[model samples]
Target: MNYSKKIFCQPLLWVIALFLISSGCQPKTEEQATAENRETDTESKLEPLTTENVVEVLTSYEKEHADSLVLISTRHGDIKLRLYSETPLHRANFVRLTKAGFYDQGEFYRVVKGFAVQGGDSDTRTMKNGAYKIPQEFNPKYIHKRGALAMARYGDERNPEKESSSHNFYIVQGEPKTVQELRAFEAKHNMKYTPQQIKLYTTIGGEPSLDQEYTVFGEVIEGMDVVDKISEEQVDGQNWPHTIVPHKIKTINQ
Candidate 1:
C-alpha cells in the first residue's frame, strides 16, 4: 500500500463523515428556526404584535423611545401636542407610530363640531380593524377639557373594558358646560366630577360627558386654533369632512 495515498484518503473520508453527522445531528423545528432567526435578525423584522406580546413589545419599546411631544402638521396649521408621561403605554405607542410615519398625510376623517376633531385614519397608513387595543389609562386628574388629547374607543356596549383604539385619537373642541350642566352629567353618569374638572369645564369649556369614559393622554400645548379650524370643517351628515383634512404626525426630541 502507498502510505501517502492512504493518509489523504483517510482525511477525506473523515471530512465527509463529519459534514453528514453535523447536518443530521442537530434538528430544529420550523418554529424554533423562525424564533432563532428573529432573535438573531433584529434589524429587519419586528415581532408580530398580538395580545400576548403587545405588553412585552411596548415595554421594550418604551425604554428606548422617550418622545413626549408630537406635531401634527396639516394645511390648516400645525397642532403641537404634549404627551402625558403618566400614560406610558399610550405615549409610547404614539411615539412609535409617529416615528414609523404611520400618520403621514392622514385626514381628520371625523370632525364633530363642538365635540372633537378625530383623526389618525390616514388614507395611507390606517391601522386595520381588529388591531391591538390598549388598556384604559384613566386618571382622575385628566379630564375632557377643550384641547384635551384623548384616544377614541368603541362604546361600552362592546368595549365594556373601555380599551382605547390603537391609532384613532381626538382633540376635544368641547362646548362649555355650566356648573349645573356638569352636576346633571355627574348624576346621570354616576360619576363624580373632580374639582379640577369642574373648574376647567366651567371656565375653559369642555365636554364633561367624556370624563372617565375615554382615556385623555395628553393636551394641546399649542395650536388649539388649528384644532378648532379642523373641527369647524364642513362635513356631511355622517360626520366625515367633505374635503380631506390631511395631517402628518412626527415625533420630536425622541
Candidate 2:
C-alpha cells in the first residue's frame, strides 16, 4: 500500500489461457474489524441474488462506501485484500456476499500457473438458487496487476456489456514482462501503456492483457507467497487442482 498513488489501468469467456494463468495472513485494523462486525450483523436482513433483483440489489450496494477488507483462506495460505472504493458496485457486492457466508466451502476450481486462480462457485443447490449477475464495474483506476482481485464473467458474445458473475472471482498472478514484450502487446491490442504501467508490469509483474476486459476492484496486501505456491500446484487437464484446494472467504474483522 506504500506504493505510489499513480493509478494504472477481460472478459466475459475468460479463456484464462486454460493454460496460462496463476496469500499470507495479516492483521486487521480496529476500524476494519468493527465494520466487518456491523456487516455481519446486517447480513440477516439482506436477500440473496436473483434474476429479477440483481440490478436493484447491485445498485443499492453500489451507493455505499467501500471500506472493507476480506480474507481468502485457502489450503495454500491466506490472502488479505483491500477493496477499491472506485469500483463501488464490485466492492459492495463482494463485501455483502462475503459477510453472508456464501463462500464458505468454495474451492479454487480454476488455476492457471503463472496466470490466475479462480473460485466462488458454491456448488450446493442453495447457492444456485441465489445465482444472479451484475453489470460491469470497469474503471481506469484499477489494473490487473499480479495479486489483483477481479470478478469472473462469461464471454463477450454471450455478454456484450461484460456483466460480472455474482459469485465467481479471480486473482491475477501473472509473470513479469520486458518493455519489448509490452510494445508487442500494444501493437497487437492497439493500446498504449503509461510509463507507470510499464514500470509496474516490467517490475512487479501482472496480466496486462486482461486490463479493461474484467473488473479489478481490489489487490492483495499480504501473503503473496501463498499465491505463488498455489499457482505452482498440480492441476488437471481443465486446470483445476488435482488435489482438493479448499477455500473460505470471509470479511476480515481483525
List the RMSD of every prediction in angstroms: 20.9, 11.1
lDDT per residue for candidate 1 within 47-93, as digits (tens), equals 33544566777788888987888999999999989998898888888
Model 1 residue 38 CA deviation (Å) reads 17
Model 2 lDDT, full chain set: 0.68
Over the stretch 1-254, how does candidate 2's per-residue lDDT look in tens digits?
11111001023234434433221112233344334435554444446465578777766866763546898898788989998877777888887877666677466766777888877753331332144567888776677888999987756656677777776788899889999988887786567888998888998899877777788889999978888888887876556677767788877654
In model 1, residue pairs whose N, Cα or C atoms come closer than 3 Å (at least 3 residues apart or on different chains), thus clashing, are none
TM-score of each: 0.77, 0.77
Instruction: Judging by lDDT against the true structure, name the best candidate.
Output: 1
Q: Lowest lDDT 10-mer window, candidate 2?
A: 1-10
Alpha carbon lDDT of each predicted model: 0.69, 0.68
Model 2 segments more than 4 A misplaced: 1-16, 19-46, 62-65, 122-125, 184-191
